[model samples]
Target: MLLEKLRAEVLEANLELVRRGLVLYTFGNASGVDREQGLVVIKPSGVDYDDLRPEHMVVTDLNGKIVEGNLNPSSDLDTHTLLYREFPAIGAVVHTHSEYATSWAQAGLDIPALGTTHADYFYGPIPCTEPLTDEAIGGRYVHETGVAIVKRFAGIDPMAVPACLVAGHAPFVWGKTPDDAAHNAVVLEAVARMAIRTVQLNSLAGVSQSLLDRHYFRKHGANATYGQKS
Candidate 1:
């Protein structure tokens, strides 16, 4: 039953990516981990959202091998698996070629922390990893993608920053579950859009450190608790 719930959540979140206009055709995918089952439920590779169904979601082990499914898992599975292995607390991951974020990635620019909306979720900027060399990009590319993200932000706190752009690629986000990860994807795209607009107005302008500190602390700091308490 728990596995079924995770599968359902993963399917629904994939559709939400389409609903938000964050993806074009079959450009994005979402996945949820069933930790007890030691498997991940993810969108099938190259499948259009209109054709996506609960049964179409593939089940795979942490190694990216399909454990159960008629279709193939997303090509980005290895990247997702690496993250899960490195961070047991993350139960969900989302990868999207969302327009605004991809624009920043194409330019090799980081998404600046621009407002309370951006700061509340990510304490600082959404980092864009340095471009991978041809050798690294050619071998075990997905795994190397994960390595780049970790190596780029080696000293930062992961929870405070849930997403990163893969240099010339798109954005990858992780959360406690696929639902949370999808939420981060949407938020990331929104902030990216804002940042792009802000740059148009004035490239030198950015969110003040004091405001970033206040917003992030009130929502995600040691003493912070969002939503209603249990």
Candidate 2:
């Protein structure tokens, strides 16, 4: 019963990515973990959004082995599995090649904490993890991707910063559930767009620390509502 719900949730969330224009063709994927069962539900490899259904979703164990479904799981399955195993608190993962965020990744620069909108979701600049080394990429690129994420945030709180850009790649976001992860993905793209526009308008402008703290506090601190009751 729970697995069924998670499958449906992951399927719908993947569609949300398409609806929000965060992904083109089948360049993105979403996954949700049923920790109780140690299984994950994710979009099938290369499946178009219009054709996706609950059953079309692939089920795999935390070890990334297929448990059920006709098609193979997404290529990012190993990366998702690694994150879930390492961060039990995370229930969902989203990966996307959205134009703006990917642009930042390719530049090998972090997304600055530029506006209140950016600080609402992230307390500081959204970081970009370094590219995986050739040796690590060959050994287990997906696993090493997770390692990169963990190392980048070794002493930091992952919850406080829920999204990251993979250097020379795309952005990946996580949350307590598929919905939250999808929401973060949308927010990430939006903020990335804003940041780029800000730079275009004035290349010398930078996000100030005072603004960042105020915005982060209002939305993330004890009094934070973000217009929604928690």
Candidate 3:
């Protein structure tokens, strides 16, 4: 079985999105990349979450060419591929239309770090990309979506933030693995919800930079000490 392990991981990550309520119907996709093999395993396009299987995961190369599986790859395969190609450190990518996160995307607003909950996962505000031009949308849209994300993170480190809202669209997240990517998707939604309520209660209030840095660093990177040692 070619890419058997990667296929299983990708399938589980996709199902995790559904199980966590980050996706409804087929509104999300998760992909795991095998950088050594130059292939990615992703959910099949439009497949029901309950009906998905390990073998149903489609394998494609960095150029988005199907390498295995009978069904078409996720409609966002190019988005995943472009990220993997551009950001070599990321091992997985997840795209979701989760309610709160998508709401922020559609509103064209960033999710500010309003509390410790937001700072624990995201280093600062979750940025929303600028709206895509008609010409870019008309061209290779999925590829353009990836380009938009890359453009938005001009000076931002993807590892520290790990997620972004696509203006007028949805949220895209990534991490060291498929499971990690899915986890970030869940966290993004939760923070987005809290940010909405936080603003409603006090529009001028936000997390102080001192607190944001303390919480973010304590849970992320080599200096992190929030959880048990590996």
Candidate 4:
């Protein structure tokens, strides 16, 4: 029952993925961090979505030490841990092999911000990390996946974008909370689907920087005007 609230939120976020069709047969996982406690709660590896409950969430420290969980953490624990360490601002992380996002990753291309929907969530095209080198893949790969993502964001703001497609793999997304990360994952898949169809109709069509700026800033930044003010 440790971190009962966090365990519940993480559980709900995982269920949200299934509800949104963002994951299949437990193919994805989500985690939330209690920043003050420096601990994480994540789904157990290989557990079916239908069978998951709050206590099923495994708790681990920032370094991946088990603090309260009886089951093993998700297979991607290292990646989530590394991200938490490297990107201090994020409170949650979500990984999903969602159809369209994974398609973009498989194709080794960025999902261009060709319209406003994408701009609303991401400040720019969703970047795809360079494919993992054979050596990196062979050595500490789960952790190396995070290394590649961190490397890709050298000059970019993780909050501004909030998601990255792992080349030839899937998308990893994070946000200020578990719910927010789940929201981004859902948005990323929607935009990815739209981007695919757009290229099919006209490969040259693209969103202008000015339009991208207008849409993005309306929902973000100090001057954000989207929705009512908090």
Higher-TM-score candidate of 1 and 3 = 3
Pick by lDDT: which candidate is best?
4
Residue-level lDDT of model 3, residues 68-165, one tens digit each, is 98999999999999999988899999999999999999999988889899889899889999999999999989899999999998899898889989
TM-scores for the candidates: 0.94, 0.92, 0.98, 0.98
Q: Predictions ranked by lDDT, top down?
A: 4, 3, 2, 1
Which regions of candidate 3 deviate over 4 angstroms? Answer: none
lDDT of 4 by residue, 1-230 (tens): 78999999999999999999999897999999999999999999999999999999999999999999789899999999999999999999999999999999999898898999998999998999999999999999999999999999989899999999999999999999999999999999999999999999999989999999999999899998889865
The lDDT for every candidate, in the order shown, is 0.88, 0.89, 0.92, 0.95
Q: How far does residue 87 in candidate 3 sit from its true spot (Å)? A: 1.1
- Tens digits of per-residue lDDT, candidate 1, 149-214, equal 888778766678999899999899888878899999999999999999998999898889999988
Question: Cα deviation of 211 in candidate 2 (Å)?
Answer: 3.0
| Cα-lDDT of candidate 2 | 0.89
Task: Sum up the clashes in candidate 4.
Answer: 0
The segments of candidate 1 whose C-alpha lies over 4 angstroms from its true place after superposition are: none
Task: Judging by TM-score against the true structure, name the best candidate.
Answer: 4
